[model samples]
Target: MQSRRSRTSISISQQRMLSHSMTGLSLEQQKMLYYVGVDVGTGSARACIIDSMGNILSLAERPIQRQQLKPNFITQSSQEIWQSVCHCVKSVVRDSGVPSEKIHGIGFDATCSLVVVEEKSNKEVAVGPDFSNTDQNIILWMDHRAIEETAEINATGDKCLKYVGGQMSVEMEIPKIKWLKGHLPDNKFAECKFFDLADYLTFKASGKETRSFCSTACKQGLLPVGVEGSTEGWSRDFFHQIGLDELVEDDYRRIGGSVKNDNKGKNFLSAGEFIGAIDESVAEELGLSNHCVVGSGVIDAYAGWVGTVAARTDVSLPALAKSDREKVGIDRATGRLAAVAGTSTCHIAMSRDPVFVDGVWGPYRDVMANKFWCAEGGQSCTGALLAHVLTTHPAYTELSQLADAASVSKFDYLNSRLESLAHQNKARSVVHLAKHLFFYGDYHGNRSPIADSSMRAAIIGQSMDNSIDDLALMYLGACEFIAQQTRQIVEKMTVSGHNLSTIFMSGGQCRNGLLMRLLADCTGLPIVIPRYIDAAVVFGSALLGAVASESFDKSGAKSAISASRKSSIAGDLSQHNPKNSLAKFGGIGGDDLPSPYTAPSATASTSQIATVGFPFPAPDDVQEEQFDEDEESGSELNFKAQSKWKKDMEDRMKGRSSDNGDTMWNVMYTMTGSGKVVQPCAESHPDRVLLNTKYKIFLDMADTQRKYRQMVDAVE
Candidate 1:
């Protein structure tokens, strides 16, 4: 199939792209040399136009098209994704009225999906079941078609697999490649070339074949992504074990044998080095200047990390005095975790020393801007799960019609509706709505701490009521579940020596007032939603641009690539396995933890949850320059929600059904709050235990279905 380019309507004046429609007043627009950050998220491509000081001038987005060929098969068009990127870039440039030549540096970030192309024709290679449809060549990062292959690879117990949470996931490229090798026409495997999606975008934009250290190390499952003190070379034993030794044949060119050396990846940029000047033709095509430099890109979540965490450090460092110098570097950078939440949530923390947490993705040496070791934790779904629940619910049509009538998006309408329902229920907010409904967010799978791909999402206390109120409460429950998952990851990290003081968050969920407040309240950790919350990823990519632009003159980038760069020394990494708890991921069985079978103490009623569990103050719809300029508004907002919230959580778990003869996973769905004191807002005490007694029902149902599938497969 000939996939058409994604298009956007805009004014093109004199072959130099003028800006798109600018909304509201600009927050100090500088017509001087600007940087552009392009972020390709799961659903859309967004671009941010920023000045020298990391202040965003305007933003624009173009949606990418995707195809779900089967329940477990997802595919995309590299050409279309690239086209959408181009459209977003052009649109942002047009929207901000920034001239083509004035744009100095541009950086890109994308989901770590796999893109397959035929080098001979420079066209997508057919990789799906429908071989004739070459456009379906890109495998989405979320696709699970390679699960069996991943399991087979895991069975081999290759050493390199240890770096990836000690398991080979269907999401990684290695397993996907094996699946493709076994599924596709044999010749096609040799005929096509593979590129992680981020690398593909950079190649498309700058005509450079160089890959980012982040993409190759973290996503390809080839480089020892987060493991320290190892050669970043392809594992011959692993390929042979998996029966695809061809990958190493003929100079290992298919997967690129050359990699970042222990000292430095000369060709690899440390998240922000300039890769190449934009190609002349592509520059002209997108109305960008030949002077536009492409910064070394990163995986989308890492980009979000930069957008959030770094907003506190790097941008504000230059102004610090000599006395504050010692405090400026490693300690500050390592103290916070970047929580990039969208379709999925990836928790990234950096440390001067490597952290070896089982069931976590990284502790990769110098992965973040080539300075700190990064540890990665993730949830397979968050906003994506919430969307699924809302859209697939019976109330969706009615909800959508009402949302349309109110001239607002269904999400926004639901938010307002949820607040009204809380008022109607005589509660401070609908946070306690979990009393009538509960949701487990692992619908996609558990990505971190537990690293269980077989895990499934569950909901208890569901009813036939299809009213907007019911849907709204269900949405609230889903958000709380996501918050609980964050706490679980945080607990794992905190236990592993990375005590995160603050959480810097970016992505779609940051804007959801309810989720943000719950995250803060539940975790008892302050979440700084950057002023550029909506464009955080784009800004993160832009920071890469800032580091890449020659005028910006990042000596750190040069020194990182210099011969003086140090190789990480190997550490004693004999780490214990993450606990496999059916009831919880956070210290599920330690003496410190409460017994799973134990009942909650006679704590006060949950009336206080409704009191302190209020949403963070509604964000100013348009962020002001004062907040935008201060970048590190590690601006902490605390919801004085503690005791009652904790008691309610305890109640939800106390009466859950056990697996008597079957093994029902005791998924942790809520956080035990921080003992931090906050001014009390309400004191109404109410008994709300919605998930008790029903836990075993959902668990049994899921287990039964799970076994039924296994039995059916065996019969086949």
Candidate 2:
């Protein structure tokens, strides 16, 4: 097979798009200048065309194909992805009736998955044996096939790891590269160039070495730009120490050379820097004018930040903490942390100064659009977990039938069914159904403050009621836990010195009303859903392009007209105040709230709600309060379920760890990496009891991971 240069030829699909008069008169309804933003996500590629006013004129999506070669390993084709992008761009422009010449610039954002190619020809390489097609060389970001490599790299304690929330994981590029060397030493893996998926798209689109600081510094675990001593970029000593010394001497050309001091001074570009116009031949093939500038690309999450807080209608100093004028994504102001939820969810919090948070990734300088430092907390699975919950249940077929009967999608049915349940039980609402169930949500391992890459999920309070309603209740429980996980991250960040009071959210998951409500309820904080929740990330990409192309200026009258800013954005809160529950679990007093890191929880369920916390609900349901009674005081249903879930999780770790096979730690890697064993759950009730019980679970989870990791890397 011959190595082929990127953009050597446009695919037939792209050509078909150009041939059709797709950009018809509707797009020509007005002769307005527009910018296009392209967001390449795990499931699809979306493009949005926005006029100078920042209002979207048209939006379109093209699904990208993914192949799961094996358990815990996923692969994709960059060619397929690029074709999807072109299709979406043309579709949006056509639907909006925007002329090709009116499009000023385009910006791209994508998952931080790794793309591997031949360095010289920019041709895709065969990533693994299960893939027969060499062009399927992009490794999905969620792949965890490099656990052993990740452990080895972490053992070196390289300074770069510090930028990644104090530990490294198999999801990042360094470990993936190490896995490539260890597993396929003689194959294409050994001789390849790597680009975090964002840069890969930029290179494919503009045919230049364009890399954004957001993806390069934030997700790849590189030394963050603007950190005091990181001007030299990659640390050769750390590379040699980890036994991957080959990456050191030749200026680390395979992984990233644009940042190496020797490579034409092509250091990281801010999210808004225009990388130049799209390649002329490619632009023609995709029906775009040669003048359409392509802006530097950003990780999909940072792009979410752009659309949510920095959109055109929004002139307020966005959530950029405090920083200089030149940075992208950075505004003169800051407020809420933004949660971009999809397959995996990331919580992005910005602070004026660097805050060293344990287990959370970042504190990366200039990475948040060159303004405030960034702290990222994430869950490995969110929407994916909920899908598993809905599909695997016995009621799934019935639910689907019901949904089809009602002429709605399954997810939409999920919402309607829950509302029906609330309507059926006059004394209770959806909250009543959720109270009967609980979930751990980390079936794919913990990715935030707990930082365990090997953690499995757990469920409690399941009943023999295999009805669709039962499934709905279980789904509600799963959403609750996902929200709680975010709450845990928020608490951890608050303890580490952030003054966040609200969360601004984007992505597919936010479209689920129950999810947004539950998150607000569990965290006891306001949850702000941007107008275009489903395409906020895509819109954010356009915002970057608009800024890059000078269609949207930050210092313009629109911004200056609304200079006064409030500390928090307001939103609807859940009827139940879960802060009492959070406070109890976090272990702060009911009267005075102290940072959990310094004060710590004393016992379960005793912590106090922050004085400025969730809106106090007019006491509606007393069941949550009733559970606070001693073990001898209630029906023991909730208590028993909670206990059962804990025991199953501990047993899962014990059983999996005892094996000596290659999958000995499969439970940890795929689900979780907990270390301790405790007796069966004890039936108990009380806000204090619940809080203490859950806290113990968190502690055990953390301890389990530490012990297991130590065991794996022992000096045998």
Which 10-residue window in model 2 sums to the lowest lDDT?
667-676
Per-candidate TM-score against the hidden true structure: 0.71, 0.72
lDDT of 2: 0.62
lDDT of 1 by residue, 1-716 (tens): 44322112110111111221123424222223367888888788888777543456677788888788678888888878878877878887887777665676788899989888876666898778677888888888998899889899989887666667778667888888888888888578877677888888778777767777787767655554334344545676777888888787764567655554543324454576556667666876677866466777889998877666633221222222222244433344566788888888899987777676788886665455454567889989887888898998888999989999999877788889987877877875566555656566688877887787877876778888888788887888788777767877787788878867777777656657677766766565666655455666777787667556531222212211122322221111001112112111111111112222111221112232211111111112211111122222222211212222222222332322212101100110011111111111222323112222333343455466568768988989
TM-score of 2: 0.72
Compared with the true structure, all predictions reach lDDT values of: 0.61, 0.62
The ten-residue window of minimal lDDT in model 1 covers: 661-670
Off by over 4 Å in 2: 1-31, 185-190, 224-228, 258-265, 311-333, 419-428, 551-716
Q: How much is the lDDT of residue 39 in candidate 2?
A: 93
Q: Write the per-residue lDDT of candidate 2 for residues 413-498, one digit (tens) a residue.
A: 98888888888786345666555455666888888888877777666677788988888888877877787788789888899887
